[model samples]
Target: MKRKSLIITLLILGSILFANGWDVQEYPYDLYVYYIVTKAPEKYENLIGSSVVAVTSHRHGDFGNAFNSSCKSGVIEFLENEDFVIDKMDGIDSTFLSKSFIEKYFPEVLCADISVSKEDLSYIWENLSSKYVGFSDMKKRGLNKKKFNKIKNTSELKALFDKYMEDCHFDMKIREFTYYQETAYDEGCKKSKDQRDIYFEQETSNAYYVRFTSCVEANANYFTNLEAVGVIGRNKEFIILDARSNYGGSNYVQEKLQKILNLEKYKGTVIVLQDNWSTSSGEVWSIFGNEKSQFKTLLVGTHSGGMQNYDRSNTIKNDDLNIEISFGSKYLGKILPKNYLGEGKGYEPDIWATTETMASVLTGLGVDVTGITFQ
Candidate 1:
């Protein structure tokens, strides 16, 4: 009889604990809640309870998993009255709090103020003539800068920008204004590897192929690799520069490549290959080679990635959340051509061909590929 009574009592206690499970509070949960309430109160005031679930269930990155695992689990609970109650404590290390983790799990919270504002429109309008290179072109398309004053949000602003881009056939990938969000892991947790800047292959006696995987100046071999291409391909009748899948880096690297290749003095035809993955500075370099080169140049493959309008980025940090929001600060409008592509629209190729069909395509274009191989 006594054993039965004890079992019943334990069952009641277990039920109570389970019922009050969400009523518990911990430091990490408190910090998360505090950040949401303080930084983005208007956006998250109603969704605080749901955000707690998201934070707890988040398992995509290293920091999230470490902080939320059972080994480091602290009692967490949200109340209807907006009260945080603590029943147990298991502290999480502050080192695990990272900007990448917050960005991945809580993008809305991080970018709450990303919506377009009246001030933003006013500033763009005021600087349109002097700062925006596309100003005259956009106006020629019947897009009045004043119309932007009616934009209520980011979506509306983006729609207006998209319309202008489509009408002008500009690079739709370059935005007149943009918010940049970087979700990469912090430097401490990132893995390092040795990577080559460029790869060269002699396809035939008359033809050579050079693939630029990266144009980052940070790479110690960047200049050396470009110099090697200039030396090796100087005598080739046909030079194929493949920039497919290259993410791009510094503008100076592209400038260095241009100087090294010295296309103005070259006698051979230069074919610059690009795909949708060839983005930022890579796309710029490809476009320059095709449009600005002194020698005959052909841009092959699909459209190049078009995120090249913004030249610089600025960051705003939330110290409490330990998160940084990066935004495009410098617009490239002043220097880019009037017909330059917009954000989201990449550069169109002169010859459309994939890696598999490149050999056939070149042959069709009257280029001899009898002994040449495609990779």
Candidate 2:
């Protein structure tokens, strides 16, 4: 009777603590262990059973050393207790715990509309860990192993989402609205010459100029239309692609240009004008134009904006620290060659053209660039 009574009391206490949630500063190890096993994405599902404790120790140790040196003492002790190697915790960014990851693995969590902010996540971690006896007996409730395979395409995914949206009445953001805007821009660029900055010098009869402001689908369509109208054909001796101040968008436009135009057929000088504002997709396009073009494409103007590697990021709210942690998951490769670090060091120019000298450079090619603005 005494043993039974003690067990009951402990169970009640555990329930209460679970409802309250964890204080990460006080119970960091407990919180970390709970999240890494239960809440982390399926991609990291390998980190579930036996490796949970080690993974938790590794992440916490990394976090502690980087952000708070005071926690390093406690974190070190925890790692040692777990039999985890301290050296293995080197390159982990534990600040912004994966939000997209959770969404991908557990879409059901979205139906609850729970505000899982930094404070909320901490509270959840505390609550979950408080009631936890052992991982062996943990309930694997709603995690469907074949969730991704169920919906093969976007249409099927949309159908499933529609059912959920109707049942939940969740306020969905208009993400597809940009598609309509892109369509309108495409139509305008194709129909009206004034809509886009594309010109062929009839006086020189040998120079074709196109100042693409952005590397978008619309600009690609406009360039295609220009090609159809005989504006960028074999008649030209020189082609000036002014992408100066273009801060990038999609590289599909560049790909389309290479495909439809077949730049090699027109054995003219392909000059690409770029500046500090030419970045991201713009830099990518410049690199593609230089490498893919059979006729070596000349990169004119100053160095481009060097931000190369493309990655999708999620902003996680850290209320405790009063800062937002933007965590990037996927690492899309650099635009330039392996030697160049495109973050700070952009692509070097073959013929350097500044704001003052650009007009003269164009004029030297027997093409007047008086009214033409660097788009």
Candidate 3:
């Protein structure tokens, strides 16, 4: 019995020395929680009681099979109060707290997903290093300082992401794909492509309408559809870039569209129609039209969904535990205005109008919008 115990002890020590042991240190959720607390302690200090405290308590302990099981239980307990934790969140282990932040605080403005591979790190690195406007206010929005400090450049960030990928896991929870979400995305794409008025069309001598949806410009259909909007904006007296249902994508859409439309020379009064659905680049375009457009511009609608910043994310999956950790490294807001505070609060519209009353409101502004509809 004594010889057998000695052999087991040596095996455990060897596993630890080789860094191949599945201990508390390797538990993605525990490490992630530790990263958040250590990195953004002040931001999340007050929200302590459940798994936040539990995970943070054992940051340095050896994580074996027993520890992982207990840690998962603790995390689930902490996530019980979060509004969006559907079905006990059995699949999630490390992303509970940040995911809560996404669902509760920045639901419309930001997106993060569980990834089990390192294939997308290069793309993530590119976005993180891009130019942003408001660089100082990142901490207020929960940017992890510890992780940010380690990644000073693109190469460093890539290396850090690679480090997280050392442990491979097949997260059953994350692997449980929801077909409904994909179906919705497909439907939205179809609707945006099929919508005819995204390109500018003359409805009257002084009034023009463009019911635009999405800023995802790679689609050939969108490029083909919106070409006419540029043709009319140069000579039209009034232009309406409708963005009531915009959800956002690349800013290239704005850059390309403005160039194609010759918006700088357009002498018309351009009015942007936005609402809560207008997010990310949608909000950016509205702000651009209102403050930077060469033509006279007016933004009409309710508060716009303000998710103008860019996010850098890392996804870690532990196949042994069947869990995944999707976390953000940085939140770059360089494109936003210097003093912009419209992240969660959204951007207040100059003329507050809902979908029902938008057409009437447009008509009142000397825009003979007889058949124009807002989406």
Best by lDDT: 1
For residues 157-207, write the lDDT of model 3, one tens digit per residue.
434433332111101122322100000111111111123113444466677
Record all residue pairs in model 2 with backbone atoms less than 3 Å apart, i.e. clashing.
21-127, 22-126
lDDT of 1 at 174: 16
C-alpha TM-scores of all predictions: 0.48, 0.41, 0.46
lDDT of 2 at 305: 55
Q: Is candidate 2 or candidate 3 better by lDDT?
A: 3
Q: Mind giving the per-residue lDDT tens digits that candidate 1 earns over 179-260?
A: 2322112122211111235444556667776666567764445556655666677777877776765566665655655565
Alpha-carbon deviation at 128 in model 2, angstroms: 23
Candidate 3, run of 10 with poorest lDDT: 178-187
Task: Score residue 173 of candidate 1 by CA lDDT.
Answer: 15
- For each candidate in the order shown, give its overall lDDT on alpha carbons: 0.49, 0.41, 0.44
